[model samples]
Target: MRAEWVLSSLSQALLCVDGEGTINYLNAAAEQLLNCDHHTVLGLPLESALPLRSDKGEALKPALLNELASAGGEVKLRTSGIDGREAVMSLKVEVVRGDGGEPAGFVLLLASHATASSAAAEVINHLDPLTSLMGRREFERRIDNLVNDAATSSRSHALLYIDIDQFKLINDTSGHGAGDNLIKAVGECLSAELFAGDLLYRLGGDEFGVLLCNVDSFEAKATATRLVRAVKRMDFVWSNISHRVSISVGVVLIDQYTLERQAVMSQADVAMYTAKENGRGRVHLYDVHDKNLSRLHDEMDWVHRINQALSKNEFCLVNEGIVPLGDNARADACRHSELLVRMCYKGELLSPGQFMPAAERFGLMPQIDRWVVQAVFDYLIANPQLRAGEVMFSVNISGQSLCQESFLEFVYRNLRRGNVDPSLICFEITETVAITNFSVVTRFMERVHELGGLFALDDFGTGMSSFGYLQELAVDFVKIDGLFVHDIDKNPIHEAMVRSINDISHVLGKKTIAEFVESQVVHDKLAAMGVDFSQGYLHGRPVALIHGAGQ
Candidate 1:
């Protein structure tokens, strides 16, 4: 297509300018927009042809024209119409790249009031009067567009939910005028920090939204932190009373995982709430793995279902056998199995991976732990032969349950009631759990050991203080983390890590159990490394201890 044909086809006014800001060409729409003859304005500078000013009536600076020529973005300004009346115009500036991809000149596209006055008015109506920033409605509109763009182009954006801390106190103590001034000052300060493509919006009274274009989690977090620090340093003087303000920011990354605009806002809101809950004047990034935020709407639903299941005894117990790897007769004589809990909801079996995270996050793990203990005891009482034999069941306990004062008492009570042998039970605690509630877990392990029950450190290699905790806590076995055991036969680093963990555990006189042992090669490797036990799909999947009861 011819350049002139394309320029004339555009309905918006188009002007071609040289590097010196001298106008060289004006399309038909541009001549009609300026209401001037094309020959008369061809050689004139942009400032001479069109008198431009800011919304506040300040003359447009020469520096801004230079910035516009190189900015490659759109900016809004007011210019005089043919009748000397003020007209709002949106100017999109683009660099005209030469054959060598160097900046040759510039093309300025002007969408004027004559062409889009109604649309411009609609946008202006959505601007906050005090801050002159886009309001919540426009924010929502932009978010929707960003969401659609992300879906189509695989682009990423970030949404920051910023809330001024103690803003209500400021408004209540000082007058409304002072509060308005503070808000305007904050808006200006934040706007100054924004880049060309970034957007700032006044979501509501004390809340604002920042739309960061094409940023990842790290960039978004850094920007949010900067915003928080900026707000913290802002000093507002009202009625001769000096006041300092801070902000709590919640950041959500917008990408393919984002379901919709509301989802994005909801995630950001949840993150903001987390920041407030943790402490004011901080930034929190939304974690997709966080159960509380992931199922925010269905939290109460899960709570109710879990409560119902606990009351009605709808939870089931399963077990997977752990086989001894070496030729240790003692290890082979004592049959070991890991106890897993599952839920039966509406006749469907649910794995612990689905509900245990929520159970732990909401402080319901103690109750669930008690239920699992009672269920295991009942199973032992029913199958007296297994309990009387050399079989020992390893029950997994959550960190929350371990810290509770009543959990240990509850376990003792169950043991006494069922008259079950403590020697047949072994409790498993993760390495992280042992390190987090160190004192309580140590006491719990001592109490269990005193009662002839053993303890195993689960996911041993995942925590930073794994070896240190193994030395501190008196665990009889260390279950190597599955991440180090999943493909040990194929990955040298994983094999070396597993070997190091095994050697360390042996040095501490604790047996090592390597989980995720999927292949014969892995099993043989673990045996050769002197690992005590191996557990994974190669052994057996978890099955109901009481056949047909859980299913």
Candidate 2:
């Protein structure tokens, strides 16, 4: 008893067991380490303390007693106790040789550390320690391995890349602890569903990946369905707050005959982006036939070029002429043209088509808008003879800029500094942009109106659905979209759209201008429609700012 007590006090874990592998004694250190009192664990059988094996009572690994009897000095093996929580144990077993020089029973003195060394840490680092699931690195590594294996074996594997929908919003509203719990729940649910060969990985922050080896197309699809269903059924709870999480999955089967494993993975990535584009919570297979990826690459490149253009001041605005509603009505009156905006880039004047959509996507619309405003002001300041009343300059505003109070403030300060008469400026905002944020639009329009400014809803007839929203916004003027005016000469529908819009504007007590009036016939057709004003190449093309018509 004294020897047992002394040995138990000297080590982290010390236990005595009979030849039948039943634990008879456990000392103070073992109880303290395992978070149990000695009295509770003392007489518990070894298998009962750590029930890792099934009910059949089979040991997960060979019994430590058999090994200790053979090698009496130091024996190293892994074992777990107190509900299968792991520990690394180095056992120094004392084999009491009987008078016959045969081993009696071994007294095992054990010391342990729960932590692992750096080498083991690196391996498990690719696995989430809490759930023992693959991480991003492990996911990728396994995928790579499977790809190589398939190449040699002439088999195929599939990768399912998944993104949790609206996870950021949830994470922000809930605490990070909740986010962590949610992720752990997902990992657990996925682990429960996938078989031994399939691997689930959390690829950091609401994105996960799975590598399914030896899975064909049908099996891959079925696995994706299983994963989606698993995620759907899981109600992640943290702090008693529960929420459902859904996922969008993109799958790519390795084409070992044609592409490398990395390429196959990249194809899946592109497909994942497509799934996101088509709205979330659906699975999409990688379609190699689609050229959308090429277009996306080009668009990204174009976005970068546009940003560079803005930085280098490589873009300029051209002023198109906007005449009065009745300027050409009398047929002989002095026709004063209102200034319209066009853009010049790389020493060539480009229409709005060249960059507007790309600009909107890259969030460069506000900067482009600011540049337009500044350009008009700079031109007016430079050409002193072009007085405030000489011509009204129409500058376009982007929806993105309108949503920003900082942009509004900046516009106000710049306009005030330039001392440009606000009334001489006709600010053109698209109906689409104005209707979406009515409150901001109302406040901005009111502020600009107080400054003696005028606002025109450009592209008006395009969203004919917004008549009620238009009345609610109540701006100074409406410029019909060029689509209706461009084909008025040929398309009777276009003619009717213009006529209806013009009449509606007149009824609302607001003015309407016909855009894209490229010919006298179209201009005359609009005039007959009672369109207030006409603007296009017919009046004049956008030109560089001139003092007096390039004199």
Candidate 3:
């Protein structure tokens, strides 16, 4: 009964066949799979008890199992049940030899196709193909189990987040093959140093995560430091060039306080970044009250929220009128409406100021910017009246997006695909973005110009080389920075800064727009200085960008 219970619980079906090809025993799983009870088929010939055909539609007899009793191997066959159900299974035959070293009987193990495929998929999902290290999915699984264990017991676990220092330099100089080789080498080096029970994972890119079980805080720190020192002494050789490698580690102790995997991972990530920030190739122990951790936790929350917003279509747009100021009533300003994005999170509408920093830090700006472009283009498609000629729309592009060749190609495809006039759309890039991605930004501006689209240099007068970059950007509008405009009415220094920016922009044939025009006094001063347009709360607040009048 005990042996029967064990065989009954086996996921794979099992059977026993004598050398004479007669079935003598069958487990519960085998009975169900063959669509018969063991009592009904135990004494029957194996071929007659459960008739099966191979994948090629050829019937295989019971004598095939007798032959496999000596040369053990497997065969693929499909069994058709009495209930009109069919199952494809791989059957392995093991030789049950007698004490005389002669074949006596055979033991059969059968795995259904569905079960085999699922097992293969589990391996693919949990492990990274590049380094053969467990990936984030596996990390979360083990950590969640450990967290649950910690809740009921005093068991302690430590999480160490490791990032390869200056890894981008290797990729940039040696190409991706070299980078991949280095990653694999690093994984092996780290794995060699881990204890038998320790867990290591590749958390994507040049980052790895380690889980140290049943360790105290002091031991966890020492382990993290050892790993860092181990990595420091390693040399990775690629294509005849020998390069030194190092990793910065962040160690977080998971005691009774860890609520979930995300909390510990985020804390470890925060500590890892701090270690990198305080100069790479070291370990930083996570403190509950660490200021960096607190800031990073908030940013991590925002990152999750931002991703949710993008996927759920909770992101929306509003418009603030970029009204023409005085005689400088430029048609470009009159034709354009500033399109600003907001997040409809829960019941509240969040401005870009609330979430933009997080979006920038985690490299989500490219995705967000792509979402905005597609959304704006979709809106224009739905509303023909809003297309380029009558009312031009200006959308802000991120510095991160500006640097990608794919993003530039995406913009070009949209411009050529749409019915909307390219001349009616304006792409606003910040002065800092233009300067930082100088060549890429220049190439983008040239392409947009060729397609008849307009460019606006936003947040002007902020950079030290603001005027110097302005001479080369060829933007239709130079938006004066709000820092200088916010206090233009009170401070002469700010007034002079705005004045000089406006004058330089005009000399280069670029229209100037003053931002943060909060009062009539500020408005009049900007108009007197010949600023072409103004956008501020005093002129008009942001209104829902509906199909009709609200915009």
Candidate 4:
């Protein structure tokens, strides 16, 4: 009667299994949870009613009772219920000894921990508080288990690392509250689109990760494309302002070929960044076609050579002319070649594109920038005629080096030490990196402006733009992006955008520069459209105005 009453009072479904895993008793809650009566459950094998299996499917050993007696603790057993619902049951098997202290049938209390919360909800709720999606801790734990299981079971899995495009722009303009709302909306969309077996994880701030088990590349890529399309269709409207959002995804298939979890993740990241470089708002798959890998290899090789060149002072400056506005409204007011820097590698001259990206990756850009300035100053000291009157030289400033305040101070110090006029040197910053850290960029521009230095916004109209931010940058020169200027005579839209930018810049007291002007037809069209200055094959190819020693 005591046992019967004890069975009647349990809140969780309780089950007592014999040493052979045959059901001996069923509590009232257990009957309700499994939708079966005591008569039906009792004397039946546990696995007949539940899909519960151990690391090995052999009936849970009688050793459980011995171990529980020694440990005095509970163990968790997970299985599916009679209705095929996933369930978690805690098992505590206590030793029941006979009068002689020999082991008899043990008492087992199996508590169902699987009420109300579905497996999906349970998984989602355990994520990080901020993102309301799988936290990094949970992600690592799950991946670790997957890897461990794969080692023995020979299963396969894949992970997709997704990054949102122009996320910072939203955070900056609309405030972080809007940003948080957008992130949640994206998470909800992902959750709805994924199937039951797949898991979508929010990997912190505008980045999400997915874990797919037993999925091949073809299916994985198809799913990824669907996700990308789903996201592409999503429009976020905040305070009556609507904006379209998109993502770049990098999918990595995990199998015997994948060395480790970190390596898999790194490959996905590389692929994601590759997508970014290709273009935003598109999906780029990881393949052997990406020349970046070979380029990266060459870049590493170039890094050593660049370092050696820098140490040996094997860099030189060759000025490219920036023509001033003239009286004819079409000719230059005496064009002068601004000192541009170059480095020699293995007896061959390497331009900025060949080595700048690698230099920035390896933390050598600032040193390279300073070396260029010093090299130009040395050239100016040697050529007094070039320095006479209002001479100006244009120097390319890297986005990475510009972010470092110390680098700016170094440039200022060098200019003063070289006795070169700050007004005579123009600093060129590409449009993409200028808007990266908007507030920091504005402050930097103001500092340089105070010293009578000039600023040129290079590659304008190339990056995704918010005209509001553009107006705020207030640069002195607007260098039209090559895409807009390239074949402008053929593309009316390109011509229109260039003309619009030119009009906007001129009205704001900023001069316009058209780069990549290839033909006389392009030059004539730009001049007719009132372009202030043009630079390209039509004007001149980038050539050395001054050469020596290594020449």
| Per-candidate local distance difference test | 0.81, 0.69, 0.82, 0.72
Error of 2 at 453 (Å): 6.6
The lDDT of model 1 is: 0.81
Error of 2 at 281 (Å): 2.3
Off by over 4 Å in 2: 1-149, 167-206, 236-244, 273-279, 289-429, 432-454, 464-466, 487-500, 503-509, 524-532, 539-551
Could you give candidate 2's per-residue lDDT for residues 1-551 as a string of tens digits? 24552443332466666555556676655554455655665555665664333223345223545654566665444555667665554556565556798655456565553322243666666677655666777676566556655664556778888888777666767977777777777778777888865767878777788877666888998888888888888777766777878888889887466356667766666667667777766787876677886565456556667777778876765556676545545552423344444455657666678767767865678888787788777766665655554556677788889976778998888666746778768787898888777789889888888888888898986664668787777677788889878987889888887888889888888888887788988877777667778888887776665533521
- Could you tell me how far off, in angstroms, the CA of residue 116 lies in candidate 3 after the best superposition? 14
- Decide which is better by lDDT, 1 or 4: 1
- lDDT, candidate 4, 124-159, per-residue tens: 666767667777766765576555445534556778
Provide the TM-score for each candidate, comma-separated. Answer: 0.49, 0.55, 0.73, 0.46
**Candidate 1 positional error at 507, Å:** 2.2
- After superposition, the stretches of candidate 3 with alpha carbons farther than 4 Å from their true spots are 1-127, 135-138, 165-179, 237-244, 330-333, 387-389, 547-551
- Best-performing candidate as measured by lDDT: 3
lDDT of 2: 0.69
RMSD of 1: 16.9
Runs of candidate 1 with Cα error greater than 4 angstroms are 1-295, 329-331, 416-418, 547-551
